[model samples]
Target chain A: SAVISQKPSRDICQRGTSLTIQCQVDSQVTMMFWYRQQPGQSLTLIATANQGSEATYESGFVIDKFPISRPNLTFSTLTVSNMSPEDSSIYLCSVEGGRGSGEQFFGPGTRLTVL
Target chain B: AQSVSQHNHHVILSEAASLELGCNYSYGGTVNLFWYVQYPGQHLQLLLKYFSGDPLVKGIKGFEAEFIKSKFSFNLRKPSVQWSDTAEYFCAVNWGGADGLTFGKGTHLIIQP
Candidate 1:
């Protein structure tokens, strides 16, 4: 199992501002994913952050709104740009427990509230 | 579009009470099923998973789930729950090794002391 840590466990930001959430893994991983959870909702996949490559985003999500950077295998960052009240959600990062392993391990998540 | 469904929104039970959370998926192909738990103010953790194995699987913290392929369901169960078991549970499904998963709305379990 991999231990993942995220920064800014909770933050309140003003609208139109941007907040970057960082995810660090104790071990190298092939793929890291970003997700969002609105209040009282399930987790939604935002994008797949690949090391040294552009992130693959899911439907209804784009890089311009939520840009991602993965400079290495053990580190990745997701930025929620031009925030709004709708962007007020818990952003989480996750990685597969291992290569070819289906189980996933997730970060504690950054709870961002846009005011 | 492929999706997952969790029927219960919130559940309340006394300590040592039995628990079951229903999950269903809407994909018509081979799939992998998982149950994850999120403790208050914590990250999501895997409770159990089902992937081309015996229908019944056991997991940490005395949690278990049975996969019913015919019904497209993988329901989570714990014979007895503790106050510490109070958390939000999410059901997820991944199709054919896609490396991507779809999640259910999640069920909040409140185990009263």
Candidate 2:
């Protein structure tokens, strides 16, 4: 398993502003996943970031709203643009446990509060 | 639509009491099952997983789950409960591939000391 970390552990932003959350992994990984956990809701996947490719966004989530950049295997960034009150949630980044390892290791989540 | 379901929304128990939380999913393919626990103020951590092999799999902290493919259920169990075990438990499933995990509405477990 790789050690993962997320920057700006928490933040409070205006409804129209944007915030970029960064995820850093201690070791290189193949695929990185971004998830959103709303209050009292299940975790929903936002996108999958693979190095050297365009990020794949899930249904109901668009790249324009959640732009991601995966420069290398060990790092990725998710920017929540044109934020709204509904966008306030915990954003987390994770890596598949490892090759043939089915588990996933997650980073300390980024708590975003849109006011 | 593929979804994971945790039947118990909230569960309360005392120390030394038996524990079991139900989880079921709608997917009908080879899946990788996982149980993750999130303690207060902490990130989600893997408790155990079942890809293949024995239907009964043991995990960390005396936790275990049985993968009953016929019933589309993989329920978590522990012989005894402790206050430290109080946390939100989430069940997840992923078809063997690049698909992202589908998680259940977590079960909140509160163990009284």
Candidate 3:
């Protein structure tokens, strides 16, 4: 089991502004995942952040809009650039130990409201 | 891309009533199934997961799920539900190699006391 924490639990931001959400895990992990959940909806995978290379984004998502940074195994940050009302959602971070760990732990999720 | 479908969007039940949530996933090949619960104002917690071995798996909070590969379904069930079980339930699926896990729309459960 891993303990994950996110900064800025809930924030209200204006349109066109960007907000970077931080995720910190207690243990080092090989893969960190970012997910987005719209108002009263299921979660959608945003990207997969590895410690070294670029993040792997889903088809509907792009790197420019949701830039991810994973400088170390225990930490990663996701920035929602040029935010809009449609971007308002709860962003979550999850971690796994890789190699058949099977279990993935999630953070409290950052609720972002765009105006 | 894999997808998950949940049959019910909202379920209302009285305390001590039986609970069952339908979950079906696309892709018949080997897959991992999981049920996650997100209580009011809380993070998503893993209720149970089925990887291999027995198709019938039990998880935390008296929750159990059956993995029926023939039907591509992993339905969650509980014998008796309490008012505390009022929360949103999400069923997720993954192939075990990738980082992305496809999630169902989620079922909003309101257990009346």
Report the candidate with higher DockQ, 1 versus 3. 1
Report, for every candidate in turn, its global Cα lDDT versus the true structure. Answer: 0.91, 0.92, 0.93
How much does each candidate deviate from the true structure in C-alpha RMSD? Answer: 1.2, 0.9, 1.0
Arranged by lDDT with the best first, the candidates are 3, 2, 1
Model 3 off-target regions past 4 Å? Answer: none
- Please report how far candidate 1 places residue A113 from its true position, in Å: 1.0
Candidate 1 stretches with Cα past 4 Å from truth are: A99-101
Cα error of candidate 2 at position B89, Å? 0.4
Evaluated on chain B only, candidate 1 has a TM-score of 0.97
Error of 1 at A34 (Å): 0.1
Model 2: per-residue Cα lDDT over A1-115, one tens digit each:
6789999999999998999999999999888999999999889999989999999999999999999999998999999999999999999998987654446889999999999
Model 1 local distance difference test score: 0.91
lDDT of 3 by residue, B25-109 (tens): 9898888889999999888999998889999999999999999999999999999999999999999988755577889999999
lDDT, candidate 1, A45-104, per-residue tens: 999888888999999999999999999999999999999999999999999865354567
Superpose all Cα atoms of candidate 2 onto the true structure and report the RMSD in Å to 1 decimal.
Answer: 0.9
Task: Look at candidate 3 and tell me the lDDT of residue B108.
Answer: 98
Q: What ranges in model 2 sit over 4 Å off?
A: A100-102
